[model samples]
Target chain A: MKLFKKMRGGLSCDDVMEVLQSYLDGETDTETARKVASHLDECTDCDLESSVYQNIRVSLSTNKAPIDPVVLDSLRQFGERVSRGEID
Target chain B: MTERPTEVDSPAASADATEAFNRYVIPELEVMYRTARSLTRNQTDAEDLVQDTLLRAFRAIERFDGRYPRAWLLTIMRNANINRARKKRPDLLDDPDLTFERSVDFAETTGPEELVVDPTFDASVTDAFAELSTDFRQVVELVDLNGLAYQEAADILGVPVGTVMSRLHRARKRIRDHLAEHGLDSAAALPRGATR
Candidate 1:
């Protein structure tokens, strides 16, 4: 907190957060995203958040458990049964 | 019942749902189970809770209305687990440290850093996250991992978008620092722009 006092309101944890979220969602524009990227390269604290957000992106995207085929088949059948009014 | 040469979005949805359930939801079981394990802190209770989430998800899908099926599924699972916990023990809501001990004896060979390389880093990160006050962790999980837009995650969690944004920043910073203190920090190993 003390370290970032120099950046002024021009760059804040919130601005960095917006950039971080934008980066993860792949929604940031080319120019500002680039600025955020370059700034992060030099800013250790921002770099830490940048790192965590990306890892979070990967973990959520890739590390999920695989739902079983039987479970899926079972759910599909249940969907069918409900569509047919088999269950109240 | 036959594979149509052309895709019907409805039937296709069912198939895609099946596939998503298999490809996405199934893979998350252990992780979700691990989360449930952390939340419940008992193997039997975690298993029961997980099974309940699966069943509830299937039932909920019948009337579900969302385009992002995976996020919708996780939302259901998360809500289900929380409701079950509340029902099981209403009083423990405020007291978080009841279940798991704070300290972990990480493996010597890997140290904490090596383990950060694995996807289980979420578990470590999540444990760090778990250390936070629940209000912060709620917003972090909803917006960050679940990928809801600020307003959407807020709408689902019933909070203001501004609240979600700020709490998330605090929770995120605390998580990063906690990982650092525990030696699981990913800053040194991660892609450069990633940390900034």
Candidate 2:
């Protein structure tokens, strides 16, 4: 939809995670901040969605779990690519 | 020299930047991975995406001001993921068997049951959250999950703050409507803490 497009396009899954991050941090603007608030008002889905994304990223105060070894290796290789400046 | 920061254009600078990145920034690999995982919801894709991002950051480190190093790297990751995603084909209806396979026991690593907060909802909340379009999910991820400021998210997303808020508002509202339609919450109950 054009409206969604206006929000911007090509955003990754990480971009969808901001609901709880901005709210808990208290950095979200009053009005835009209310987006989360207002979303909660009528939509339980956003409420849950916001909270779940929070769980995955922050896990509250607990240390984020270690990534899988294979995943780490991939990142390491990607990092090597970066260090090597091989990506176009 | 090429306008883009390239290894060949200035090997010394790239080398110095990579050394500094490895020492000071690469240590955040785990953190980047977690963020990437949350975004991609696929362990393999998340790792590759983060790897691609780290590589991009290393190459572009010459332009990095060493401010908000993690966020800078995240922006690179976020952008790389988007670009790579565009290169793929979307074939939702092409294969019924593949769809059936995905729907059977196909679970996001982070399920609603494992989710930390209770948020006064039930089982269907998971389905609703899953149903949201990718755009809405992006706003929730950036501002709500990772806690990047609107300006920073804007920097990564290349949108105005107003656009961010409005999209977040509408996207979230749509999700709420979805939940309500699913009969997950009551309209008359004593309203626990407001959803905000």
Candidate 2 deviation (Cα RMSD):
11.3
What tens digits encode model 1's per-residue C-alpha lDDT throughout B125-164?
6566556775665555455544456665555444566776
- C-alpha TM-scores of all predictions: 0.47, 0.53
Superposing all C-alpha atoms, what RMSD in Å does each candidate have to the true structure? 9.1, 11.3
Query: Which parts of model 2 have CA positions greater than 4 angstroms off?
Result: A1-25, A28-70, A73-88, B1-19, B34-42, B82-107, B112-124, B175-196
> Chain A TM-score for each candidate, in the given order?
0.58, 0.40
DockQ of each: 0.18, 0.13
Q: Say which candidate scores most in TM-score.
A: 2
Q: What is the two-chain DockQ of model 1?
A: 0.18
Best model per DockQ = 1
How much lDDT does each candidate structure score?
0.54, 0.54
